[model samples]
Target chain A: MFVTPGYAQETAPAEGELQTEIVHEEGGEAGFPPFDTSTYPSQLLWLAITFGLFYLFLQKVVLPRIGNILEVRRDRIAHDLDQAARNKEEADAAVAAYEQELADARTKAHAIAQAAQDAAKADAEAERKSVEADLEQKLVEAERRIAIVREAAMKDVGTIAEDTAGAIVEALIDRKPDDAAIAAAVSQVR
Target chain B: MAEDPIHQFQISRLIPIEIGGLDFSFTNSSLFMVATVVTTGAFLYLTTSSRGLVPSRTQSVSEMSYEFVANMLRDATGPQGMRFFPLVFSLFMFILVANMFGMVPYFFTVTSHLIVTFALAMVVMLTLVGYGLKTHGARFFKLFVPHGVPGVLVPLVASIEVISFLSRPISLSVRLFANMLAGHITLKVFAGFVTTLSGLGAFGVIGAVLPLLLTIAITGLEFLVSFLQAYVFAVLTCMYLNDAVHPDH
Candidate 1:
């Protein structure tokens, strides 16, 4: 800041001069502004009035609104956070429940499938055993029939041979002629 | 130096005539006061008008002022005191601007004048009285009589309390006026010393240097005092307002 040389010089007393007397100049003190005492009463009155009005405005208007806004904002945030947490928990529970149900269904299906396989295996085993028993009985009966048929065939062959031998002997004896017929009959009888 | 001190204080001459035997020299001081009021009013109006979520620079300054007063009130009167924030804020701003503007070379420091300070003090006092009366009615008289004092001490205590009550205006006014007046006078004296010493020969130049530095330092200090004084005035006003509102406490 630049000082005006003229203004500074005007206020400066002569060097080495200690003057107690305040020079009351015609136009006011050299560099200082004049003081006004008149507005004191008015200023003070206005101060009180304005202060009162301002207090009234703050009490009635500003504070309540600000307080309400803050309270509402806090409540909303808390509510939102709480709701979000609840939804998450519920979702987690639902997911767990679904997973459990899915596992249970799989277990039930496996049990049903295992039960069907077991039944099929058991039935096949029972049928195979019954067929084996029936075939074994049929094989025994066939062997017995073959044995009886062979015995009967053997008896019939013996009887037929006897009959032929008797006929030959009788022919030989009765005919008395041919030596060859009589010898052949004796040999067949022996 | 001017012969008449009155001429120094002349604000201006409007229709140059005596009104009711009072010489009213409408001087430069008067013009500055008018300017101060207009500027203060306009500044406040512009700053507060928008009241946006994000404040403009002007608005931020105003908001800071509001916070300063709010904190002061809160400290003095607790959370309940928040209701009085605007009054305290306005008091601080008005006085602060007036005090600061007076620091300019040609401006009149309104707070320096006894009459101005007295009026301001009287307003604070009257509000305390009026509000107390309005709220407490007849019981407001009992403010002088403290409970649990001995019967013999009542009269003396009451007398002393009355005097103390009456002294509020004087104390409030004188504190501001005296501080401002003393500070300005000291500045003027130092300024004179610097100028006079600087004018002398070689050694005088060095002598002037210290005084010049001191003046610079004093000026900065005075700036702080100006703001501090305004704040003290407003805070005291709030304290008084609190007393008025809650008389029993």
Candidate 2:
């Protein structure tokens, strides 16, 4: 609902003292509080006073505390988020380091395996050379023994051949050949 | 006869004082106004005395009230409106408390009076004018002229604009005053019917039931209107202020 213009028109002329007399109708009758002409000034004065005091209190005490609380809460949340991000980065770095160290260990193991293989190959090569040298020495010794035995056998064969020649002559001409004669004969044949 | 429903609104001079032939008497209205201020102060002070990250129930309520007004101001007037947060908040608290106080048995509602609400509306309007003039200088009158209005209709539109702009105080004051007045008057009327009917015999007792139920319903509705009116007053104040702050279109 709206304020009646008639009330405004009526109160427009009754400015100063008449307003008060009308408001304090000793009996306080005939008008609604909305249309009452007299109580305007004091009510406005008190309202001004009351609201002014309230404003001061709100500005000074209440609003600042609320603003401060909200600010503190916001800062706390932001700081927590920052700390969380830093921790996450640190964790990621630590994982990367672990991965790097693991890769290095794998590489080192490969290098150890490669070095062991090379060392085994060298050992096998040296053993092969020594074994070959020892075998060659034994073969040389065996060949010398064979040569000595063959010479002995060859002497025996020469004696047997003379005997065989004597026996054959005895059978064919009823005579035996002597060792010296045989030797002379063998030399002539040579 | 039942008590006059309008009798409750009559202003009584408690400590009659006259200064310079003016009636500046201490009154029933004054008593309730002081009570509203005191109650509002006590609530804020007590609820917020000890700050906690996890708030108490009272603290939550206090904070909600703060956020409610703060958000309204921000939504209507932008961050620039924060400067008047104290005024807006105080107006809301005072009106809300006073209206709620009127709901209590036999308590006077300061907001129900036209003089009180008009005083508040004038403060808001005057602040708008004062700050508009101060901040925008003479350009503040540009509010009376709409952008894109035809030059031929400019004077007519401007005059209409000026009238409506001036009526801000009346509409603002009367809106709250009327809601409270009408709601309370309806409530009183229904309640009076119960008293009047109960006097008549058995038939009267039977007739009182309907008015009693209506009275109960209106009382509950008045409680809701009390909070709503306070909200409207504060929101309208913010809008008027926003106009002052940015009086372009």
Candidate 3:
């Protein structure tokens, strides 16, 4: 049932050897091992040596390495965080600049649209004024031509009436009337 | 026999060295102590050799132990208390590892011995008094005197304070030693029961199962006590060091 080799060894000759040694040293007292003062010197000596070595090793080697690792990690994290914050600030500035440009472009576009509309309205007004002046001059010229033609037609009608009257008088008198008579009669009729 | 729980703690000389007529022979206790130092050193050394930005599993253990003791000392004695970090860390690791090594079957428990524990406790007390006196000089006595006490009761309180202060090392040492000693004894007794009962008939075999279960349970409990005692010792050391640093309270 004893699994460990140490236990088996202890159960064998070593156990008897330990008992005899204890009996010989302590004069058959067989006292508790821990309370045995005879072992104190050796225990204290070894404890000091081992503990001192351990302390020196820890102080010199282990601690500084652990401390350095922790400090480096902390510094790295801080640096990364600072970098992230800087990048965010830059991005924010870029967004603000982008929005400012967008607003400026919108305002400029509105001004350009307004200028185009004003120019178009001015062009339309000038074209209408010129067209109205041309139409008025054409109407005046047509009225003058109509008046001259009506005067000419009235003179022609008067000549035709004189000729017709001379012919009629000649037929009644069975002789041709004189040209001077015709002219005098036509003048009396006017 | 395995029936004798005290048998496990017997220190047999592996090398019988006699120097100046004193028995300075290297014993099993010494062997385990050296083992503890080597194992602890190697663990810390190898695990941290990588020094990965993202710590590996073993590296995390080393780092956690460092931070655990570091934070405990810091919390107990504040930042200036960190000067004794090496001492506190050493005591903590040594006791912790020694106690754990004791849990292994047939392994000598270094902390189970009274002399060893007392010696460790003395280290703390010596540091406390030495550092306190060096830094604060005569003012270190203020640790024993209460701030607000009746004039008539001053002497009484101071005497009690001094007595308690003197008893610190004894209690500290005894606490660790007694716990380790008692726990190992109980575990051995239960295990011995299983062996003795199994030698009987089938009924005895059935009876042995209970103690076997109990042995397993107590073994687990001992492991806890092992870690806890180490922690308590270190923390108390920190508190005592705090008194050395600031003795008014």
Cα lDDT tens digits for candidate 3, B33-78:
9999999999999999999999999999999999999999999999
Candidate 3, A1-190: lDDT as tens digits: 3123236555565667656655754674446788777787888888989999999999999999998998899899999999999999999999999999999999999999999999999999999999999998888898888888888887776677667777887788878878777777777887
lDDT of 1 by residue, A1-190 (tens): 1122123234654433212123422334442332433432343444444445544554455444434444565687899999999999999999999999999999999999999999999999999999999999999999999889998987676666566665676687764345555446555665
Sort all candidates by DockQ, best to worst.
3, 2, 1
Docking class of 3: acceptable
- Estimate the TM-score for candidate 1: 0.61
Scanning candidate 2 chain B in windows of ten residues, the lowest lDDT window is: B1-10
lDDT of 2 by residue, B49-146 (tens): 88877789998888889999999999999998789898899899889999998898677778878888888899899889999999999899999999
State how far residue B39 of model 2 sits from its true place (Å).
Answer: 1.0
Give the TM-score of chain A in candidate 3.
0.69
A1-190, model 2: which lDDT tens digit per residue? Answer: 1112222223454366335644554545545555676776667767777778888998899989977776787798899999999999999999999999999999999999999999999999999999999999999999999999999997777777777877887788787756699867765664
Give the alpha carbon lDDT tens digit for every residue of B76-155 in model 1: 77786555565566567767887898677745565666666676677678867887898789778777877777999999
By TM-score, the candidates rank as 3, 2, 1
**Candidate 3: clashing residue pairs, number:** 0
Query: Candidate 1 chain B TM?
Result: 0.87
